[model samples]
Target: MPIFLEAKLLVWLSPLHRESWLWACPELEEKPYAIVPSPIDPSQFYDMKLPREGVICVTSLFEFKGRKNVLQWARDHPGQEITCAGGNPLPNEPLPPNCRDVGQISPWQVNETYNKHKAFLHLPATPQPFDRTVSEAYLAGCDIIGNKLIGALSYDWFKSREEVAEHCGNSSKLFWEKIEEVLND
Candidate 1:
């Protein structure tokens, strides 16, 4: 806190963090700060034109990521194919027969994974600073199924997949500009 208090600038990863962090230390308001989300490279995730099918969740299956909720939802929809990817697996929470736990995949495989699925389910139990997976999934042309707790959804520009994709396409430029401003200041 003291280090931050003495800093010339602070860069928050998302708008949600900017709000929540400021509330934690209102004194920080006196300093310059910028909300620069971690940029997602849209070039990696292709926009699928072909009709996509099934549901895929790319988040780690940690307890805090609402794994139990996802499991229950999968159980309720027994016929639906839910592909659960990523690691940090919880103990004893067996996946429903309908849900397939593919565990983690390489970065090169992420785009392919998103392309294979029609919908992306992101239901974190707590507020994430910013989940780039949401942005990646959005760019890959997957319909996002997430709660309001998704920090990226707070942005006005995140209205639709196309809108989010546009923002992400320019995210690198935006991020660097913010950094340059901070450096110059």
Candidate 2:
């Protein structure tokens, strides 16, 4: 906190984080700060026009990431295809029969995964500072189903996962407009 105060500038990746930081230290209100989200190369992630089938959850296989919730959801929806990407499942944490665990996918592969999957789930136990996966999924045209704390400015407040998924899909122009707005600010 002391070092932060001494710093000339603070670059926040998302407004949610910026707001949390300001709330934590009201004294920092006068400090210089900017919310610039991590960049995503459009060339690397294009709409492949692939069939958006099945559900996918991308995140480290940690308990707090709501891996258990994903597993339970998979169990409840046996007919739906579910894929879990990121690190391997924890010891003794066997995945359900309906779920396929693709541990630790590369960024390029993640783009492809997002393109292929129709829905993306991110049910983290705690609030995320910023979930880049959500943006990636949205960019790739996947339906987003996650908690409100995802920190992506594009998503509207949604109650149910289905409600969120219904609003999936993104416009590159809109995304670029947001980037320009933040950068120009």
Write model 2 residue lDDT over 1-185, tens digit each, in one string.
Answer: 89889866676766677777788888888877655555555455556898888988887357777776677778888998888888765846787888788877876587788888988888777556667677667766778777656666433433343333333233334446655665687
Model 2 local distance difference test score: 0.69
What does candidate 1's lDDT look like per residue over 62-181, in tens digits? 777778667777887898899988874664667788888888899988888898899888888877778889888888888888887777877888877667767767767887887788
Q: Tell me the deviation in Å of residue 44 in model 2.
A: 1.0
TM-score of each: 0.87, 0.74
Residue 3, candidate 2: C-alpha displacement in angstroms: 1.0
Give candidate 2 misplaced runs (Cα > 4 Å): 89-91, 153-185
Q: List the residue pairs that clash in candidate 2.
A: 86-104
TM-score of 2: 0.74
Q: Per-residue lDDT for 148 in model 2?
A: 58
Indicate which candidate wins on lDDT: 1
